[model samples]
Target: MTEIQAGLTVCTVLVVPYIVQAIKTKAMTGNVARWIAISVSTLCGVLTAMAGGMPTDASAWVTSIFAAVGGVQVAYAAFRSVGVTDKWLDALLALGDIKED
Candidate 1:
């Protein structure tokens, strides 16, 4: 993988789950967390594909998402041993004018 791809892979694989859990504790549900994982994995894969210099098109994005699903998304239960949720996420959402449901 290219440096960008490798780096993004690390962030998606290692850091995203922590953020997701933080969101969960911020009141996002298990279903929300699951979808968040899917969304982040898809984003990582698309960026990975772009970094890898694959075609900058939907087909390539789809291919990359499938491929990266194995490496990018760490299981929620596998790493849910700690709770790191915080108020930072609330501030982040507020910046976007998003209110919790």
Candidate 2:
């Protein structure tokens, strides 16, 4: 993933969950919406991590992940600035289901 990809991921994370919540509100309970937000957050983190590059392509995969980590850090910082870190965003990583391979 490049910076563009990271930016797109940020936008998707910012928008998709709310859209999902809104469209499915009648059938979607609080717990379901919470899980949807968690899932999108986890996927965005993974997308950003790919900015570090894939393992097969780089021997310095750890370093790449490190480099790309800052992008996610900054994104979370913005989220924090906007007070998006209450229950859902705060638990985003703790509930992340993505696994590095």
Which candidate has the top score in TM-score?
Answer: 1
lDDT of 2 by residue, 5-99 (tens): 55756575566544444444457786686556555555655555565454465434443343334444455456556766544544563475766
**TM match of model 1 to true structure:** 0.57
- For all predicted structures, in order, the TM-scores are 0.57, 0.41
Candidate 2, residue 6: how far the Cα is off, in Å: 4.9
lDDT of 1 by residue, 7-96 (tens): 776667766666666566547777888788778777877777788776756776666677556554444444553432344444555586
- Which pairs of residues collide in candidate 1? none
Compared with the true structure, all predictions reach lDDT values of 0.64, 0.53
Question: Total clashing residue pairs per candidate?
Answer: 0, 0
Candidate 2 clash pair list: none
